[model samples]
Target chain A: MTGAACVLGVDSGGSGLRAALGSPEGAPCAGPVRSAEPVRTGPRGIDAGHFMDLLLPLARDLLAASGGGRIAAVAVGAAGMATLGEGLRAELPGALGRELGAERVALAADAVTAYAGALGERPGAVVAAGTGLIAVGTDLAAWRRADGWGHLLGDCGSGAWIGRAGLEAAMRAHDGRRGGSPALRDRAEKVFGPAAGLPGQLYPRADRPAVLASFAPEVAACAAGDAVAGGILRDAARHVAEAAAAVCPRDAASEVALTGGLIKLGEPLLGPLRDDLAELLPHARQVPAAGDPLDGALRIAGGLAADRLLLPRDARMLSVHRSEGPSTSA
Target chain B: MTGAACVLGVDSGGSGLRAALGSPEGAPCAGPVRSAEPVRTGPRGIDAGHFMDLLLPLARDLLAASGGGRIAAVAVGAAGMATLGEGLRAELPGALGRELGAERVALAADAVTAYAGALGERPGAVVAAGTGLIAVGTDLAAWRRADGWGHLLGDCGSGAWIGRAGLEAAMRAHDGRRGGSPALRDRAEKVFGPAAGLPGQLYPRADRPAVLASFAPEVAACAAGDAVAGGILRDAARHVAEAAAAVCPRDAASEVALTGGLIKLGEPLLGPLRDDLAELLPHARQVPAAGDPLDGALRIAGGLAADRLLLPRDARMLSVHRSEGPSTSA
Candidate 1:
């Protein structure tokens, strides 16, 4: 009954939000996800009430679609919480809290889930380069984080980074500083205006990340022909590879997983990333994650991979737990 | 007699503001200037009201000190207006508009004035690497600009940029990702707090530019020993030099003028800048500006170097003028 007690997983990302329902071994149901902000639990602080308000609706929608059967467990993989653990535990603001059953709900950062989904709780690094970029790695001895210092400081090889680089190059070309693609110019004009007044057109806008991300595809498309765009993609790849290498180190690594929207750019981004990874860290091989972060979330929720969670030992209670139905008799 | 046809020069910079009153020949009387914003006219757009408020008092004070001299002309050299020859004419919100006689006043961008002050109307590139960085060069035939893309996109060699890099390095160090100076952490703590949470402690601050700029000295000081800090400074120098090289091409060069508060850090910034310029553009040699931006502004106002003024052909009337008494014959 109820397909042997299915598990639910949620991914809260900058680009979109997705909920996965069903057994990890079977075809999980996901999607019609909404793009929204991740959990706001940090030094600036998170609001648990607000977090529940945003998540419950999405969860209920998924549950309603699941044949109205009994629910087993729930897991969440969120960007804000994704490499959380280290010193960030005490500062975490009741992440996911007891809004659900409190016993069957588990919360892990997006990187951990990506790691679990990609490498199955193994020791290695995983780079999630989407609208944002961050590389989190564990060699089972030391934890290392590379880049993902947000969009302003580092985030070297992210889609946003690539988009920004492309836009800057386009602006430079327009200002007669360099040669750029007309198509690139068109893309800029489409978003930033035909006058090409970049700073005025870009900085003040609230959706700067999204605006920049929209240009990422243009950069990837232009990489085949345009030198500037091509160069940007190559640089992005190098940065991404370097980030992965920064975490994995020499002796304690195996698989480096590359995930997120930018990975879907295919050859333009991956080709160079792979080349750079070989040069930067030969021991760690780049591998496709075996499952989505949702799968990793499910694994953590179902107690299938509890050890895979990356929280500090004192803060295992940080994950939210909820239980229901005959399968997970909490 | 109102001081025998004197002119006023204003230097509005990231660090402080200065107004000069003296004859056109020698160094004009300057200082007691408040650090303030420049002309409010750029693609990203800037505010000039703050500049006027800060300047009017300084100008009034200088006028008072001048013993009521006949102000023949006034010139302003401001960062915001440094590259403002484009579509920012009508939008300039009363920079020297009515605070003084608008006609006799000549407003030139800081980079052009920097070029004049350093090279005296000579065809060359001038790099202003203060809290903000922008390089403008004139080959007598065409005008070219490099970098100065603002803190978000470019301004690669600027003090603000360097400080940001240094802070990022500090964050990495605190996170156990990299080795950094305890002094660096101390500086960050002083500014951001002992919590040392970067983005949360930072991004929301109102005076981010000033805060970032304050760390530049620490970066310069650490250049001699700390690898990370040293790396940041070297990169800064290279970027600054590259900006100069970008604007001033090979054949059309006179000399590259390096001027700014950051330049005061001496060889740490200048050494690598010179080296990079040598490699990047062999024709350009680094030189100290012949005079300060005040001198350049004076030159522009007295119309001694009208061609040096980097304003649109149609709207050179942005500068302010106040004439009285016998010398000016107003």
Candidate 2:
């Protein structure tokens, strides 16, 4: 281990935060360290202080493990960066420079990272569907986004949305109402106890979106044999495709990719999603995501380190900051 | 004022708590004191100690206002009493006997109180649609309930539900997606600022349901001219009516009633609600509520004071408790 230049990449989202060390050539060196607790947000916006608290320790560990190499650049892709990112955009760069002595930084919305990870800097759209969903695309100039409105308002085809729809069907079944799904009800009971007590269990929790999303797998599991569950998946797929179509580049040769943990729902979701994407976005070629958001963050960091970043910069979607002070090599 | 035998009635719900003093004849005699904070609930169930803290002070004021009359009985109608009332039920009786000197007590679910308030002891269903929605009924035997699953899972057609739907439409419009409602978007922006910031504004709040429900009136206000808003209300009405039909007794002359603050949305909601109820439950008659939950609580307390309560008692829905020792007149 020598005083080699390495870049820091971080992915912060609903599930948690992950950090990695990468070289300017886009190769990982060591440490994809993780923290299960997500960065907190509040009245001002995404809590920059909380994010720094989480990242500083992770960066120190990664640097130590990499034999005290100097960090040339840092890129952070955070979940709420597009909307609730004022605090992060304003404070993160200065804080990183002061603390880590990293002069070059790229702050990006998680969706943009997913896009970069999926299609590099090419003109394409990427659907990042996890607990929440967002579709992002660029024509090598400007970015377009759809959905990712969180669980209550939008995120229409996201994991939370599917879970909520499934839970509603389960509740309907419990109440013996129309559109009830007995299979979903059974699954719901197995996971969340009796239907009657669900409100008491769910409403008071702060992590409700993720809690609701925890049931998405159950819905996907029941999709194979249950028409109602299958219907839910089909609708979810349609919504995902619609979001993708809303932001995908218009060119026939442009690419569309799916990324995030939700892709693990596998064929039950993918089968319908494929058909919907074909119908809604026939011109765009659907492709598998080359990597996850972490990989995307690393790639962006690498690009910044080499001063050859090709992706278009947007104030909210993706912004680069360079400190005026001389770099302090570790 | 003489030392008359007055009953203590308390209504505890999402909005707050209210306590009134009434004579055994079911006539109000003194005060209806209020506390704006709702009683807290936790893993142990509805916080009995907190309820006591709020109730004791209000009870003292009511008793003092009534010229120190003896409380013959006490009735408390609380939201979530059907499911989250274990702590309240177990501890309230003993606490009330010691604190209020009332030997007899009736603990009722808010829906049961709403039913009692609406149609007395008649075999009918009552839809309690406010921030949340629940339909409860009795056939002079057992209690039946449908849909009160709260904001996350069910609570279909509730104030929160309508508001959430309206906000979703607003987001769709903001995103330039199909099914976008520009009218709703305008209304939402007026109430909640930019559409993109709504999730950040909503998701972190413990009072999210109330906050979301605050937007419901805007949806109602727009229903007359906006088709999307009209559609949301129509769907809300259908959901409310379906919930009512699910619980209404099968008797040809059984009554159905709508109760709760949601009824204030007026013709935009009620017009569709009336038609849907008429279509869904032609056998049952729709009736205006005779009183609110507070009045129902007073009525139940009065009935208990006279030992002629007519409504069938259920362990979860409604339960009666009598202290073993002699009653203490205040």
Candidate 3:
């Protein structure tokens, strides 16, 4: 039997997969509230078969971890599902529904949960800066997207983008082609090892996204004293701030919430981002994410209508908004 | 069996493989001498074994096309050989020697031949910007390289880099993340069909380097009328100029020659690059390539001391600058 007050919410991202069991009100009610693993997936995408293999077992573990308390409802905010064809998207929620029972399911692009997690029922914008960057916003029923074009095309203020800029600076410094901190080049070279050998080590590796993002921390770590690193951070934050500022529609709220892995690095990037945003979006506020994405997933999973989630037409939304008994049925 | 006065020069670049049969004096002597085929190679790098399979036959055909020329020597100025260890470098010339009765052969980085082709023994600097950008220069025996770093690490003013920047601008315009020409977004979308489906089509292709470089032309096409595209081209040329200027040592003769596929776009890119170099490197004069890389390769193969062609310790410099018939001995 499941706790009548609790529901299950799962969030999948480039860095890890996370799951939590929480109250209908989006609060943790039991243990194993958040479980994460070093699982690999991506913006370039993975086959549905592989994605499900990772997803199904993780859900079962969380459900079992709930100690016989049934999953009152289930919602998954999965990456890459937003871009898939309708046929491919049906597989995830369908498979999960078969296992966890039907009437308790909701699925969406991680981008939607990111916006919900930041803004809740209120309207504004959320720019998630992680290994990759994408912003989602809504002004009533109209949806807007800004810069989540993946690694190749766009992702302006993302960890990978910052990392690439930092690496380029390091190379320019080493070549003495420009005036940058020698210390920045030293730190960057240490990441890849000796003397101009970065290309050899970096290109052949399959885990390119993680490796590219791995340099992002160095930009923050050196920004304080290194001119080159500081310039890079400043430029990165400017791009992010510009993107974030553009997404705000000045509707119900004018506050923008920042989320994802890169945000955790703090000031070296964000301070500049905030300063730039203040100039570009003078009336708005840059705020922290009030709750995590799982909360937002659960909020939608409950009977809250988040039309922006845009689940495929055939995707069955099993609304289970009840607060009594360990019932899997709505 | 062979024309005593002839030599062969092959220019193997990311864009295409071009081979020419010419006199030992480095002048083209036959029809369609610079024959090229759309062969697959790489940013991933093609192996020497595969390279030879493509090379040997092409050389023999070019030799035969020249009406039975006893090649005085053969040189292939290929991309990607610069970073290879001595063992790998040995394979190209060794295979070419056995195929053609040539006594002398030379192996060097494509950058060196690029410099030789542009400046010859009259040293200065040469900035070759194609799918990739590399600036090479010479001051007596001292050689300097500025930004030949491939698509991942450097290649700052390259076709691939420009295309990537242009695509990012297009995405930004499409997303309304920045104020830009919608025309740029439309043109970019035309290249890869649909606004949202680009990342899907682009990221999965095996010929990522070629495809990325393909957009460089569009940057030029739009720059005259579009602010976004104009900014990208201006930035690209500036980087190329700085790199080129930095490589030159202000010798008695200070000139920087511009070469590569991107050069054909002409004024929009080159005009800014020239103006930027005038300010950054006042003493330098910007000029066109004296000859293509194949000519430089022929010079090296003809036993001209292209000492700038730095070979590894174990690399044998078999010199056969003889005026006689087909002879294998040096």
What is the per-residue lDDT of model 1 for residues A37-73, given as tens digits with 9 covering 90 to 100?
Answer: 5545554444444456667777667667765444456
lDDT for A258 in candidate 2 is: 89
lDDT of 1: 0.65
TM-score of each model, in listed order: 0.80, 0.88, 0.87
Model 3 stretches with alpha carbons more than 4 Å out: A1-5, A31-67, A85-98, A303-330, B1-3, B15-17, B31-53, B62-70, B85-88, B92-98, B303-330
Q: In what order do the candidates fall by TM-score, top score first?
A: 2, 3, 1
lDDT of 3 by residue, A6-95 (tens): 566777665566777766665655433433543344444445455566666766676676664555566667676566523335455455
**Between candidates 2 and 3, the TM-score winner:** 2
In model 2, residue pairs whose N, Cα or C atoms come closer than 3 Å (at least 3 residues apart or on different chains), thus clashing, are: none
Angstrom error of the Cα, residue B67, model 3: value is 4.9
The DockQ leader among the candidates is 3
Candidate 3 residue-wise lDDT, B1-330, digit = tens:
534667677776655677777777766765334335433444544566666666667776776677786666666676765665244354555666566765455655677667767777666788888888989877645677888777867888889988888888878778777655687789988888987888877887877767888998988999899888888889898888878876887775777888878897778898898889888778777777887777777666554322233322113212222222234344
For lDDT, the strongest prediction is 2
State residue A126's C-alpha deviation in candidate 2, in Å. Answer: 1.2
